[model samples]
Target: MPTSKDLCNKEACDIQSCLKKNGFIPERCRKVIEALERCCEKCSYNSKHCGSMSRLLGRKDEL
Candidate 1:
């Protein structure tokens, strides 16, 4: 079975695209944001790229 980190690798770009289309409005992309948060939390301590998702996004509560 694929892990959260694996899923994250596949869907990370969705967030980027959504942000670009919505003028970086996170509230407008709640679903995508939540999905990425789940992945980031799963990979927090294990994946270097995902370790700082909360810090990088400035929404620590979500992660």
Candidate 2:
């Protein structure tokens, strides 16, 4: 099974893409993105280089 962090990253990315394509407010998206960033920072599997990409994915409720 995929780790929770992996799942979070996938979900976040999907949400971010949807928000961007749908033209959602940047501020709102940023809020969730920030949360996603935090989650990525704490993830052992997260890559430093990919943190920005992880943030772009968007945030989800804590696992």
Candidate 3:
């Protein structure tokens, strides 16, 4: 089974592809962003990289 960090990494990549496929319109990828947020919550058990990414995105919820 995949660890929380692994799942988060996968979700991060998914978000990247979703961004590219949706022309980087954040509004066009709400589901993907939520999914990544869920994954990041799980990732707290293993890593904080997701926190940095969330900060980079300027998402208030993540901070």
Candidate 4:
């Protein structure tokens, strides 16, 4: 299985593409993409899942 980091690192990993395909509004998904960028910038190996996990667990309602 591809880790989130590997998924994001792929040249084809367009967040907008994924969101749009999944029926998410591009505008709303932008926030998630932005957060992912911010988190990944600080992650070791630039792991994409690290950023995603941060956003997921950071959401008060989701926790």
Candidate of highest lDDT:
3
TM-score, per-candidate, Cα-based: 0.58, 0.43, 0.65, 0.34
TM-score leader: 3
- The order of the candidates by TM-score, greatest first, is 3, 1, 2, 4
What tens-digit string does per-residue lDDT give for candidate 3 at 32-60? 77777776665553644476467434663
Q: How many backbone clashes does candidate 1 have?
A: 0
Clashing pairs in 3: none
lDDT score of residue 45 within candidate 1: 38
RMSD list, candidates in order: 3.8, 6.7, 3.6, 8.2
Query: Which tens-of-lDDT digit does each residue in 1-63 have in candidate 4?
Result: 866557445322555465668685445455556555565654553675655445432452432
Question: Ten residues in a row with the worst lDDT in model 2?
Answer: 54-63
Residue 56 deviation, candidate 4, in Å? 17
**Residue 49: error of model 4 in Å?**
3.1
Residue pairs with backbone overlap in model 2: 12-57, 13-57
Comparing 2 with 3 on lDDT, the higher-scoring candidate is 3
True-structure RMSD for candidate 4: 8.2
Cα lDDT of model 1 by residue, 1-63, tens digit: 766445575446777788799997767777776777677666663544364345534573553
